[model samples]
Target: MSSGTSVPSPGCALTRGRLAGVISDDAGRPPLDAARLAAADPDLLPGLHVEVLDAAPSTNALVAERAHEGAAEGLVLVAEHQTAGRGRLDRTWETPPRSALTFSVLLRPTAPTHSWPWLPLLTGYAVAKALRAAGAEAEVKWPNDVLLGQRKVSGILLERVETASGPAAVVGIGINVGMTADELPVPEAVSLAVAGVEVDRTDLLVDVLASLWEAYTTWQEGGDLAGMRLAESYAAACATLGSEVRVDLPSGEVLTGTATGIDPSGRLLVAHDGGRTAVSAGDVVHVRPV
Candidate 1:
């Protein structure tokens, strides 16, 4: 894909009670423009198709259905408000209308299915890099959370689907953008506005999608973390590395240790008293060093 940039025109201001007629302090936020986004990075997503919704139950779910219907690889879905959005492990993710960037992109990779676990990690890296370029100083938390300091500003969820041709992946990305303190979903969450970084949402979306496309293409070419240098890049931007963490495994076991590194398969390696353990999946909480 060729590299180029396009700036979106200023959005039309919404009058009072214009946003779903549910008047609130944040009713004037502009909606995302599909054409403007396509124009911004025309070369990033070739044969790109986009859908911007005012609200949806879940962009990921919507895209998954489309993928099963043979949606092309470059299908992009964005929802201004996701009432029943989900994060990793089915955790509910909520944000005010147009207060965040909630979207999903469908991809059908030809790489081996074994290497699919890296898709989410690759996405987190792209988000962190894009946010940093936009002046947020963001970093990735182990697998798929984007953090500014200790608070989370974004999260990613990758869902696998079986298409007629092959297996497909839908990467859902949610970013807190213009939310105020009271509008934040949780105390541990923050938005770009709250973080004191003034940004245009459209620009942020373009940067993130472009970055993701670049990383995705690189991974598809090599089909391994080492080949794409994804492991090294993820380690460099991952805040979980070198930190004391408590991981809650799926089998109801908890392991506390110092996060040493990530292995070739993208599993988090934690060093404990007994030995180093590779955790393939879990809830990781950064803790004070014991």
Candidate 2:
């Protein structure tokens, strides 16, 4: 899946610096050097066309622009930092230079348009699986947050680009790697360092990419059955279930209920005093027991 500038294949004979020159985009994030990052893993997606940049306008925006410019699928846009990095609902995702992992995957799916709603949920599964593989008991929190013992560890944002070829998706992901407690902008936000877990960023990236590629391909190839399986997995891993919560809807209404499980459509199933309501989109906050 290597593209953009011609670079030697992963196993081909080339100098380290020469391999890094594959995506020497001045406007892009500094090269992450995937060769050095990935460990000897059996499952990691080999030969990923990685673009490294020191900082970027936004990984999602950059990848989307590249897709418009004819960038190929599996092209990963990674930023050492993002100047205007954003999350779902236009919230900012901050990262100091080389302090965290901020990246996006450009993918052209073979699935039908109806399957698009499942992308972000599947992305969460990928993060959870990767974190678990790293020896942390990571769990999903409804719509899109990954948590370790009730504290946030990672976030995902999936965007779609309607190309002439089809709907090209840019799945953006960020993990709090090496950021200290003092460096966090929000008091509520915590990092891997703060959580007392040390992990090689490169190794984590490899595992995440491998898991994500598998999840994406599974959904692409008649995995509607597998999607149900994933939804069940997500629900089981989700910390939101069985917790009294309030879902902050974009329409300015707070739906309060006890989160029971996730619906087949990937919406949250919350049982309120009145009845059960399925929320397609919202920010779910766990309510403190009174």
Candidate 3:
């Protein structure tokens, strides 16, 4: 569970559209190549450091530890296999070795601490936007789940921690890449391969990081969603908006309603018989077409 050593990594946040026409072959899962990634965007990633690990318990946990040790920002820790990979509410998902993308990026944003709740949605927009640009039918579900068509293809977890220097965020992202139908953990899950999008993992990673860094930079600007256009952009990219939804709350309560919009604090506004309830968090969110 170490942060691992810093390598001459290749992950440069390169062109955002590199995944648009990526070619996928049946040549088995190619290892994430540092050399190829390094050549992507050297100039743009001046201080960004990317580290690829063969196996780890969890990238999010490790990155958080590093931040506590006074680690700098822009450090990406990617794991090919996480024995203990987890999503929201302690839920777990598994992908065979090298079959998916699981990584975490550390950031110490300059935005107001109160507005940091938007970090998860900001990450969802980056992922969905990047994949959609690559021809996937991607849309963000509220908070930060990414769905291809009606099935989920990606999930994000943003953990906030107080470091010796300041508050930092560890953005953990997992995307299904090469799983087959039988390999899916659930029926509602799909992979890039299952969704008919063949892309190399490195290319996809670079593409996603580019989108994320861009969105993060803008949102960190005074944390103004409207001024940065993240509010409307995320609204357009979110599939939960205007859809009937069932939320399994952490308290074992069920809330069924139409998801109206995201409020300023990044809570989902659901209109139901109980009136419009602002859901701060949920254990599970099920979306049905209106």
Candidate 4:
């Protein structure tokens, strides 16, 4: 969403130049056509509005600002480059201009407050589902990391904020699209191109957003993870389940265990030596057997 600009409604017709926001400095990265995204084929992004920006510090922060200002649900903010993109535990990642798919969507849920923790989990499922359909072998790591052949290819971060209209959730999604091996920020990260999945970023964005909207609405309507077999579907797409995991909890204590299942509330169920623990938040590492 932009300042001093009238935001268009879902069905309103607006025409924009085909590569309107692409900058020359982003040559190394693929161009994302704001026009294509805003046009967003009739069936895709049904009620959502997309605003593409050349750059931003973080789409999540920007959307949160809009949320505080009473922005409507379904407003999507997308950025070509994020100078201060963030992850779980405040971890930060940077995306070179136009090199990745980065965006945030605003949602005001009808789901019960207790069932809301499953938002990110369901988001991960949506992403992995989309990637699989896009010709990538992708699976969700526990808690919202989308992995390709054991390395992270995408991630979801959800931030909840109170707005005058109601409580709003800003769901941020980032996927490595055009980055090459040398451009990957970490050894454990991979891009679609590097992973050999050739795709148009605009098409990928549309597919991913459509999948997200479907999963989100269904899960929200169910009011709990297990209601419509959400937990079952998530466990199926989750690579973390049945793996040996080492969880670094926020208290500085580590729990090494077998990740058995995901509970309805969305906490990770770990079966460890001393006893079982339900992890609400942690850094999870899938241990490779020696």
Candidate 5:
């Protein structure tokens, strides 16, 4: 599922100016203190190595490369800005420097490859839970989009890479944090600050990572969503289920139906006039019934 989009030059004036401001604002922003994070939960992310980058083309790209080079699980990469951040369907995802939480984690799960589809779902549930814990009413859109009041505040991307040891999953997450109105990439995007949540970025990241780790461990224990109760939690926090929606399939066909449920494998189940269809991959949009 590798695709490319043309991005503005990385060294453009706008990028450099934004990076400069972000660097200057670091003095006042909350630092992602490794010691404090590890101490916050000794059981979570044990022996994890954290790297903070001032800028990168994409954290997922960097982490995927490292995973291939035998980078161990629990390696976390965070970047202040991503010039070529990617979202679902190879869409470009960009936010102003320091206005978002952009990071990737390398996970070498013991779960069977058949069950790997649940990774993004579990990650979405974890992110939604973390956001709610931070006082925002967050919910998940199908296939791992985190929304705060119908506006997307975060996104998750999972990539499978071949590591020296074996295959690994690189999970990339981006959360809008402090972007002002002028900085928002689109009208449907909102940030924590704009949503009226005053939170420390470091604290938010720690909470999210901890939640994700717990979810991952539980999945590994069972190798299935039902056994780990992940499906139940994900359903409870997902806003897409039980809604009239439109799905844009990869083959360029659009299906309009009511989102009935999510199957055990995490594919969306939609009921239309014809019958029921389980969609494994597509872009879903919630629609208002006329």
Candidate 6:
């Protein structure tokens, strides 16, 4: 996580209906037509201003910039293609033209800035809830991966920005909906289409935003809450629970353990040889079944 500098990036914020005028570069991409999509459901997005771009350096980057420029909370930035899409730990995110749902949401958290660590997990829970509502089998991996039957379907990256008013998060979400195996950069990557299911991109986005709003509202009430709810939902949908797995720590240490569940603070509770280590962060890999 980079320390958020207070400099606003260069870009003007678009008002609500102003986003509908943007056009995609590709003529063949039908639903990539921002005007048509927004027109179909103007009321779907509540209290949120939206901006559509044909292509961008990165939606997350642009949203962070917009936030610095005083874009209101709930402002969404979407692009048909992103040249510099990314994920957690600076992993490359593939956002080919007209193939993926590449977007970012601006959120000014009521929670403390330190609590921003859990934003990715909360966003992951929202994605899982959205997919389940769309009739796709889904679960949230610890930290920030959304899975469909043991295969990754979507990933999230939450970036923080320092605005004059306060600190805010630009939650970047890339969901693979219509991509085929050949189109996916990672051989292990799977899409909703590859899972033998088709999902409407607009509907999925609506559900995801709604779920995120709900989670945000819950967190605003302030208890030892949010993380626990996310953990429980993640655990229930996650198939890795009770399995032996390898956890890759950021420090280059790999530990083997049996997955127990997540703790209240959103750490992975691994029953390792050391006896119940709470893993705050790691790349989890389920081992081959014996």
User: Best by lDDT, which number?
Assistant: 4
Q: What is the TM-score of each candidate against the true structure?
A: 0.87, 0.85, 0.87, 0.90, 0.86, 0.83
Query: Best candidate, TM-score-wise?
Result: 4
lDDT of 6 by residue, 1-290 (tens): 11111222222223222222444545354454343334433344456555656667678987888788888888877776777888877888875676778889999988765566667777888788888888888877767788887778898888878999988889999998888788878776889888887777766666677788777767766556555665677678666678787777666677778878877666777787788877765344333221
Candidate 6 lDDT at 153 equals 89
The local distance difference test score of model 6 is 0.71
If ranked by lDDT, best first, what sequence of candidates would result?
4, 1, 3, 5, 2, 6
Steric collisions counted per model: 0, 7, 2, 0, 0, 0
Show the lowest summed lDDT stretch of 10 residues, model 3. 14-23
Candidate 2 wrongly placed segments (more than 4 Å): 1-7, 10-31, 37-43, 282-290
Q: List the residue pairs that clash in candidate 6.
A: none
Task: Sort every candidate by TM-score, greatest first.
Answer: 4, 1, 3, 5, 2, 6
Give candidate 5's TM-score.
0.86
TM-score of 2: 0.85
lDDT of each: 0.79, 0.74, 0.79, 0.80, 0.78, 0.71
Report the poorest 10 consecutive residues by lDDT, candidate 2: 11-20
Over 229-262, each residue of candidate 2 has an lDDT whose tens digit, in order, gives 8887778878888988877765567878798888
Off by over 4 Å in 6: 1-28, 32-44, 225-227, 282-290
Per-residue error (Å), model 3, residue 20: 34
What is the per-residue lDDT of model 4 for residues 24-87, given as tens digits with 9 covering 90 to 100?
A: 6566555666566666765667777777777778889988998999888887777777788998
Model 1: per-residue lDDT, tens digit, 1-290?
Answer: 11123323232111111112332335788766555664554566555465666667888998899898887887777777778999987899999888999989999988887777788999999999999999998998878899999899999989999888788999999999999999887888999999999988888887888899888889888654454488899999999899888887655678898999988778899899999988764444333234
- RMSD in angstroms, all models? 6.0, 5.0, 5.6, 3.2, 7.8, 6.2
